[model samples]
Target chain A: MTNTNRRVLLKSRPQGEPTPANFDIVDAPLPEPKDGEYLSRTIWLSLDPYMRGRMAEAKGYAANVNLGDAMVGGTVGQVIKSRNPKFKEGDYVVEYAGWQSHAVSNGAMSMKLDPNAAPLSAALSVLGMPGMTAWWGLMKIGKPKAGETVVVSAASGAVGSVVGQLAKAHGCRAVGIAGGKDKCDYVVKELGFDACVDYRAAGGNLFKEIRAAAPNGIDVYFENVGGAVQAAVVPQLNDFARVPLCGLIAHYNEMQPSPGPDWRLLLVKRATVTGFIVSDHFTDMEGFWKEVPALVKSGKLKYREDIVKGIDNAPEAFIGLLKGRNFGKLLVQVSDDPTRS
Target chain B: MTNTNRRVLLKSRPQGEPTPANFDIVDAPLPEPKDGEYLSRTIWLSLDPYMRGRMAEAKGYAANVNLGDAMVGGTVGQVIKSRNPKFKEGDYVVEYAGWQSHAVSNGAMSMKLDPNAAPLSAALSVLGMPGMTAWWGLMKIGKPKAGETVVVSAASGAVGSVVGQLAKAHGCRAVGIAGGKDKCDYVVKELGFDACVDYRAAGGNLFKEIRAAAPNGIDVYFENVGGAVQAAVVPQLNDFARVPLCGLIAHYNEMQPSPGPDWRLLLVKRATVTGFIVSDHFTDMEGFWKEVPALVKSGKLKYREDIVKGIDNAPEAFIGLLKGRNFGKLLVQVSDDPTRS
Candidate 1:
């Protein structure tokens, strides 16, 4: 086996939108697991918007990824060797392997993944962190009841896609807000969202379209995109509405202050807007893993993956992610998936 | 009886700060009680910031008041004539009687005020809607726990004054934000708050003072005044903090857009900001009336009333309330309190 390992590291903090120069791909010798540890090979690396927040120097919900350190992320991997009784050779696991070709770990922070239960790549996409983010925020925070209208922004992206579907399952009229007409169509047609508003059409008409779709007024806003989309949604919220704030993807690249409505509007509606990180409520994770997989297996829940081939394309793919270029859950296939192959 | 009733009506909607021209004092013939109704005379008229929102053309949580309608408000009055068996002459009651000398009401919308339990005028202040507003928002929404820090804005106003006192009772560290040095002094020295920051001291140092006062960080913010006060408190909120949004008096006279921090800050701390109206949770009113007055009577709760004599002064008093010129709950004595006189 080739003993060469490669990693992508943050070269410098970004002022606005991140460019390739802010990151550097470096090669090193492959790491080996000692006693009571396991060696894992990365198969799929998840790319999410929250990664941008981690790249900055500012303190956040999590620790900032230091310059020259591997950009942090979730990964679906194959365990090649195991020194502990908890694992064996040819086993799959979900881990925080960061942006690397291979990793050596004791498996304490990793969850064993079952390839036969669903596709192995699903662990990095729908069946993993991003999926949990959508579920927890919508279920616990948004809490859209029957007959209420639920609107999800960035509707074709990983978290937004699942949020809209969950809103549907909860007996709500689901509306999607996506950047383009095609993504909007996919959200409405494939995901069965009640309606999808194309935000890229015209800034002035976006609210009108959303208003038309959710005639009852928005009861739950699963906020994934910030800026104009949130500014539009704030006025449309119903009294006693709930907003589960997940990500501010639109503002992730923004250098200037984001434009929002007079926050007095939130007071006018008696609404609840909460900023939440799923990690704070991981006790609910066990329940999510049990419930979500059953729904996915029964075709009651649908997830789409926008998979890019090879580790070399990760930087470009992630850059495109912030611009809303990729649809559904964005992931990079760093190595061949043995189960799929 | 003179049989002449004095009333204040909305004369014109102001573009910014409301002036005397926006209100009119006129005398009209008092209407007689019909078969199912009773005639009542206003004794104490409550002037609150919410009335400013009702004067505007835009619709809000409640319906907008038309130009010629009597300015809506809560009033403590004595029934002069009763056609219904539930009420009798000389019995005191609290009702939404507007800014008027007389009211005709069926028993459905009014609560019988027990003068023996508390002072008749107390029904219009601490024992009334303002008191209930403080209790419900602080309990149901803010939910401050033991040792946690609680901050109440508009610290010397009716709702905020009670919010800070109640925070102390609940074993939480109570901090306040008021407009003047005197008000800030009264809040800490007289009202039992741990600390109070004067928002009007200077714009540059208000946030610094608030941060210093709440050295442990804020866990619950009872938001009565929005604008800069809210923007300052946003950075100090702890993870999973709650904000009970009751009113935005600081922006009540604002003609231009009110400035607040980009709300993405709410997403950072995983905090909850919920807007609430006391009217929505009136069932809790019974509990508030029972618990709060007991606290007041036992000296556990301290209340200050800044009462102005004559209904003619209500317009100026209300304007002063908006500017934080009045130190405590601002009310107008419309007539002799029959329970005392």
Candidate 2:
């Protein structure tokens, strides 16, 4: 029990794009579980675009990571010691442990994960927060009717992949917008999207490309990227189109206030744009957990994860995520595999 | 039977804000009703902020006014002569007659106005398009729940006035944002809003002022003005707040693209902003006509109109509307009182 915990802590606020200088890797004594608390060792860490927002001083759904604090994140871990009666030792659980090797959590903070039923890492990727985000966003906000067209940006990533697949299962023409030909190919062929658009392709305007892809016009735009991508999709939206705004990765690093032509275009199209956090829909998790697992089992839903080898690389993987470098749900393997335990 | 018709035709598109020079006064021989047609002599011509969008070349809900075409508008008029069985001479009706002294209408075009029941001008103001805009926006989009806070911009204008009254009637706390102290006073005292923020008097920091006015946060924002007003209102929006965007008068006349911090802030709030055209909601008019009239008759709703004299002055009145110069529903008295007919 003499293990030392190493973690990345926020060193300073980022001006625009976060640099390595903004983070500090430091060592601390591993936390021991107190009464009513559990000592959890991190197994897999989730790195997401939303972490970029958490790094900023501006107001967002979650508080910004304060200087000298462990960067906030969702982690899948194994409880090694539990003083709480509800959680037993060796139980795999999901917890908000930030960018740390080990954590002390109260029973209230963790959801037990069943590794025997599903892949243990899937709890931090497809079957977890990212999966739930797509479920709630598509089912609740996007509300894609049968035969409708749904377009998602960053389509090869965790949430977008799930969004596209779920939309397909709902009888929609799922269109994926990804960065490169490889991701686009994967989204279309592997994820079963009706079509995929390569946003990085030269000589093709996004609006023109999307318009060509969706002739009847996009019914739902699962907005994860804002900027030129949003501008392109807005005008092509059909009357009463719904935009489930899950993230704005494009402008997360922007130091200056965003320049705009105003959002009057959204108004003129008679479209709806709404933002949401997955936690806001937590009350409906009973319906989500019940429905999603069945979809996964039936192979109606698919997910992908970009796994990093160690906790030390989580910061770099997170930085890559903000730049759209990750091909799937970004996760960091924090410790040795538990199956050998 | 001999009538001199003075019509305002679109002369040229204005570079910025519209001026009197952008329109031309044309005289023509009054048209006669043909088979199944009726002649309508304009009584009150409605002037609205949306007309500014019509004057632009940009694609919008309706086709932009072509040069040399009569400026389109809604008018309440008298059927002076009828060749149609459905309409009779001397019957008051509502028609799309543009800014004109007289018009010839087919039986398919006019809705019989209840002259004895309410002011015929009411058909062009509160009981017609503006009133219906408020009704559909509140009922369909705003969905004002009991105890929710409803906030509207341009609070003394036709749509805003109706929106406030309807919100109050639904047992919500209604807050109004208007330009002047008078309009603010009128909205709170006369229209029954819980409070009103005078945006102009507050030195344009409407965000702070609105927050001070609605400490509970805004549930519904009836957006007519977009720009700083929208920027200010967006942050104060409560979770699941509904913004029924009826107009963007603030940006309508500007030729250059509006510079800004991007509207992507809309994505983080989990709020919905949707645009609507009243004409698109025409299918629901029977419901509106039935409910609104009852509310008006029961003294639960009140309306106001600013009547400008003469058809020749419609262009000036319309220009004034874009500047927020009109206190209520701006209308032109196209002909002498048809109630005396």
TM-score of each: 0.98, 0.93
* Superposition error at A319 for model 2 (Å): 1.2
Residue B219 deviation, candidate 1, in Å?
Answer: 0.9
Candidate 2 residues lying further than 4 Å off, grouped into runs, are: A339-341, B259-261, B285-287
Interface RMSD of each: 1.7, 2.2
Model 2: per-residue Cα lDDT over A192-260, one tens digit each: 998888888933577888887888899999988887787788778888888898988888888765764
Q: Per-residue alpha-carbon lDDT of model 1 for A96-116, expressed as tens digits?
A: 998988888889989998788
The clash numbers for all candidates, in the given order, read: 0, 2
DockQ (C-alpha) of model 2?
A: 0.65
lDDT of 1 by residue, B156-227 (tens): 888898999999999999999988889989999999999998888858887789889999899999998887
lDDT of 2 at A157: 93
Instruction: Report the lDDT of model 1 for residue A106.
Output: 89
